[model samples]
Target: MNLRWGVAGLGRGASFVEWLSAIDGCEVVAVCDVSEAALQRFDGLQTYSDYSEFLEKSHLDVVAVITPGPEHATQSLAAMEAGCHVLSETPCVYSIEEAQAIVDVARRTGLKFMLAEDYIWMGWCQNLKKIVDAGKLGDIIFAEAEYTHDCRGGMLVDADGKHYPASAWGSREDLTPTWRAADLPPLFYCSHTLGPLLYLMQDRCTTAIGLNTGAKVAPEVCPVDMESGLLQTAGGRAIRLTNGFCIAHPFSLFTGLYGSRGSIRMVNLGGLQVKAWFEDDPDGGWQDLAMEYEEREDGHHWVTVMLEEFIAAIRADTDPPVDVYRSMEYTLPGICAHVSAEQGGKVVEVPDLRKS
Candidate 1:
C-alpha cells in the first residue's frame, strides 16, 4: 500500500524530500520548515513554516523529522498526536523523560515510531552483528564506538564543496543561533556511536558515567564539545562511547567490538577497513575482511534499507524493525551520559523505558 508522507524541518529534511519522493510506495504530500527559504527548494508540494499547521493540513500517513536534534521530541510527539507515524533523526530525545514520553505516545497511538539511527544499518555494523549472532564473537565482553566528526564550530558543508557555519543554515529571518550542532553537547548525539553496539548486543545500558572534555574550545551552547563516557549493561558488559564533534579529527566512526572469543573493528582513516578475528581460527589472528557489499542501483544503501523496513512493517501491521523499546535502549544511555557529565562525572542510572 502506498503511504502518504510529510517531512518537517527542510534543511536536512530536503534530503528526506528527495528520498521519499523516490521511494516506490510513498508520496511527499507536504513539507515543513521554520525557514521559508528552505521550503522553496522543494517545488510543487504543500509547505508550512509552522509544524502544527503542517500536520493539520497535510494528508500524511507518516512524518519524518530531520530538523534540529533538540526539536525532535516535540515535533515527533506532535506528528504522532496528529495521527502520523514518526521517523526521527538520531538522538531521538535529549533526556530519559522525553524518551519515556515518546515511547508512551507511540504505544497509545499504536503507531510506528522508529529512530533513524543509520549506523545500525551501516555495512560494517550489520556485518559485525552477523558475526556475533553466528557465535563467532561468543559472549560479548566489551565494546567501543566513536563518532568523531570535527566540524570545528558548525562547519556545515554544502553540495558545492563549500563549508558554511552551521548556524548560518539553521538560522531564520533574524539569523539567531538556531544551529543544533553548534551548541549541542557532543554526547547528545551519541545514538550513532552507541546504537549499533546496543543493537548488536541486544542489551540496554543500566548505568552510565561521563567525563566532559571541557568546551573552552566549544563553539556554542554547552561548554563542552566532547563528552566521553562509559556505559554498563544489565549483563555487566561494558560499552564506551565518545561524541567528539568539536576537536580536530578526521570524520570517522571507529567502532570496535570485543567478545569472549572473537572481535571486530571498523577503522576509518585514509580509507575504510573491516577487520575481525575468531578464537577457533587456525592462526587466531586478526585479519582484514572484504568491505564490498551488494550495491544499490537506485538510492542510498542504509537510508533505502531503513525506509523499506519501515514501510514493510507498516504494511504488515506489525511492529517496526526498530520499535520504541529498542529505540530507547539505543538512545537513553547517551542521555544519561550527558547527565553524568553535568554532575561532574558521577554515574547516572539509565532508566529502562521498556520496564513497566
Candidate 2:
C-alpha cells in the first residue's frame, strides 16, 4: 500500500520528506510552508502556504509535523483531526494540556501518533535496549543522556557571511525580528537528550528537579546556557538529563544506563566508545563496545531507521513505536523540569496524561 504523505514546516520537513520519498511504499504528495523559498524544495508535489488548507486538500494518509517548538502541537492536532496519522518532532507538545489533547484525539481516532525522537533509535542506543531486554542488565535503575550542540554560530549569520535577525530579516537588512528561538528554554528542547533514555528504559518520569545556568550567549539567545534535570521514573528509578546550546562544546549525544545486575556507560562525550560491567565478567574489567549495523548498508543513521519503523507500523495497522503516551512520557518530564528550573529548583511532578 503506497501511503500518501504530507509534510508541514519545511525546516526539518525538507529532510523528512526526502527520507519518506526514498521509502518504497510512501509517496510525498503535498507539502506546506509559509516561506516561498521553502516551497522551492517541493517542485512537482502540491504546496500550500496555509496549513489548514493543506490538511483540507492533501488527502494524506500520514503527516509529519517538523515545525518549531511552539507549532508542533497545533499542527499535529489539526493533521490527526483531518484523518492523517502524525509523526511529530519533539518536544511533541509545549504543555501538558496539549499533550492530553493529542492523547485524546489519537485514542479516539485509532490513528498512529508518534513523536519523532530519532535519538532513541540510534544504533548504539538500540544495542543497549537489546542488551537490557536480554537481561544482560537485570533492570534499569538509573540512566542519563546528554544532548549538546553550540548553535550560536549558525544564528547571527550564515556560513556565507550574511547577517540575519537584525527585525526585517529578509526585507530591511538593518532591522531584525526577534528570532523565535530566543525565548525557547533549554529543557523545552530536551527531548533529544531525555527521549532516548526513557525509550530505552520503557518507563515514565514521576518527578523532576531542574537547575540551569542562565543564558550567557546574548540578550536574545536561549535564556539557559545549560540545563540539567534530576528525574525519578515511575518505577522508582533515577535519571539525569542535560541539554544546552550556548556552551562551547562539540556536538555530543550520549546515553548511560546503570542497572541492577550490570551497567553500560559511554566512555567518551561525543564518541561511541562504550564500557560495560557485568557480574559474569571475570575481575570486573571493562570491555569497549560499538554499534554493529546489520540491516542498513549505509551504516547506522538513526533517523532513517526511525522513519522506516514509523512507516512499517502504519502499513501493519499497528501503534507507532513511540506512541503519544510514551511521547508524553518522554516530553512532559522536560516540560516539568523547565518549570522546576524557573521556580528555583523546586521539584515538579511530571504529569502522566494517560491518567484521566
Please give each candidate's TM-score: 0.90, 0.90
Lowest summed-lDDT stretch of 10 residues in model 1?
172-181
Candidate 2: where is the Cα deviation over 4 Å?
Answer: 157-180, 267-270, 292-301
lDDT of 2 by residue, 1-356 (tens): 78999988887789988888888888999999877778987899999989999999889999999877788999999999999999998768888889989999988999999999886776666777778888987888889888787765544544333545322235543433223336567787888777777777778889999998886655444457788999998888999989877678867776788888898887345456788888777777777776642233347457878888888888888878887788888788888998999999999988877785
lDDT of 1 at 301: 82
Top candidate by TM-score = 1
Q: What is residue 323's positional error in candidate 1, in angstroms?
A: 0.5
- Candidate with maximal lDDT: 1
User: How many residue-pair clashes does candidate 1 contain?
Assistant: 3
Q: How close to the true structure is residue 89 of candidate 1, measured as C-alpha lDDT?
A: 91
Flag clash pairs in model 2.
Answer: 166-175, 166-176, 167-175, 167-176, 167-177, 168-175
Task: For candidate 1, write residues 7-84 as lDDT tens digits.
Answer: 988777788888788889899989998777778887799989888999998778999989888888999999998898
